[model samples]
Target: MRRGGAATRPSLARDTGLSKPTVGQALLDLEQDGLVRPAGRTSSGPGRTAVLYEADPAAGHVLGIDIGRGRLRLAVADLAGTVVAKVDEPNRCRSASALVRTVHDLATGVVAQAGMTLSDVVKTVVGSPGVPDRGGRMLHLAPNLPGWGRRGLLDELEAVLGPGLLVENDANLAAVGERDQGAARGVDVFVCVNVGTGIGMGIVVDGQLFRGAHGAAGEVGYLPYGWTDTDSEGWTPSTPGILEQAAAANSVVKLAKEHGVRNASSAREVFQLARQGDACARAVVEQEATKLAFLVASVSAVIDPELVLLVGGIGSNTDLLIDPLEKAVREISPLSPRIAPGELGEDAVLTGAIATALRAAQDIVFDRRGENLVTQRSGVNA
Candidate 1:
């Protein structure tokens, strides 16, 4: 009853492809283990009235974390996907070591607020920037946070978070979040483009994340824009590409200042002034949109995703960016996909992390209840 709760034995048997007797025995074992409990009887079904069962909230817990350069978000949920507690705080730590410690402390604190401890968290998912290596250890090209791309990043996190830990790319989690409950609900193929202090893309194809061969599928910031052969010669695996430097939030402020948009220190102010009809600020925003359009065009030409979700601090301003951005994409290439704003706002990564954690937690909780030794199953089924 992890998904569709409170089903009859026949319904459960049909859904799981098990015999009615097997489903009955499995339910008994799960009830014995306290993983599931009767939730009253069904009253209005076609067949005779039947008893119903649901997942017990006491089965286990899940913890999800979103670590960004600016803020750290944490949430704890139960077996039913209900959020128990949450914590959102600005990230003041400058070094990776400090950040790791802060995450550990915050995780513990939130779990405690949820009336639990670390041991109760059956699964923990962390959403972070950068591409994780094949070993799921070191993060690559994570320049926004100081000293994060170094090796042993996951080792440190695992040490604190304990087992059943998953560290995923933040942008990937955003796309997952959008798919689970946000804009991409039924979208089979799409990309979530995150634009903030840095830029990244997360591809969802056929209802799943498409991490390229080496787990670096959606590193769009590394895409070449203004790089020359000389620039390529100096580039390394850890170095971010010209696209991020020229198209990200910092570039917005720089372009705004160059265009004589006075007192613009951040991209937010530029967008605000543009909304207020400041000609120079609007010009800066238009340039930014064109850059984003070219980036979108390049991506659309390759994968041809059905939708492009613009997210993050600068990207969520779809009202101002969409018209110009789409027009520029049409001008740049014929392969233009429908572009839209992300529905989850700034918390997309955290929402994704929670959903992923809940999925894993629910799976483990139910699958363990169904698992039986061959001998046990033979006797029980008989």
Candidate 2:
């Protein structure tokens, strides 16, 4: 189905290395199950016309939700992996209950826009901020969304979305999204560093996600910065992490303030000032680039990826930081990997979630069909 819009039986058989009879049987079964439909005929030469088949777009649907710190994004896609509807809104829900309700409502809204209902959704994948503990009870290392790490959070989400819901780290999903469809496509070894409200990384090695034991592989925020207490009082030895304390959005704002950049409330504003030739803001940006370069060096030293993708709210500002970051990496590390901004921007996580959900949905559909077929054969044997 992914090869093209439509294909003939002989073409599918040739492409898949399957016998023509086997291909015919599989197509018949799919057609019977309403997953494939005839799409007219094509004749190459003087031979008889061959009937072409295409996947039915309405066979099943999957849902992808990205629960970010400040926004909620939801997307609905058909079995063919085509997005039908997407919705994005401000994330004002602070408490766990409110977050759950917001997700449910947003999902319903998007599915409705796609002419689907909750029951029509075969599976759902959510991309969140933190790592889920064993048994999926609570998330940890997520400070951006308040009340998100409470116990039974996954249960609450499953209660609303059904038993087919799967949750994954947002940064990891973004990396997968980039590798599958964005900047890192076809790259076997790469690291996706998301530097926004906090810092995290997604590591891909040998064409696969290298999630270490206990799922804490890419938690780069905890890297020791060795900064003295006088540098920033906000982060101490007992704080969440030093790298995040020095490089995240809050840290950027604090740096700007310390540099006497008044009236710059957000990191975005600080970047704008830097672009306008403000000396103080430029200094802050330079420091940020240096810190990020160090982070990249640490990653390269350990994993030696072919490329490093800078993503998230602050990291994607490549126009200002890319050149400096590349130069800094070359200065500090022997392995100078290609560093670039993520192409998908905020939509990376959502796209990854959708891709994951679609895969799960396809597995479920095919497994059920296979099970039914086995049961029918058993009955005949009996």
Give the per-residue lDDT digits (tens) of candidate 2, residues 253-332.
99999999988999889999989999999999989999999999999999999999999889988989998898888899
Identify the runs in model 2 with alpha carbons over 4 angstroms from their true place: 1-5, 9-29, 44-47, 227-239, 370-382
Full-model lDDT for every candidate = 0.88, 0.86
What TM-score does each of the candidates earn? 0.90, 0.89
Clashing pairs in 2: none
Off by over 4 Å in 1: 9-29, 44-49, 228-237, 373-382
Per-residue C-alpha lDDT of model 1 across residues 91-137, encoded as one tens digit per residue: 99999999999999999999999998998898999999898884757
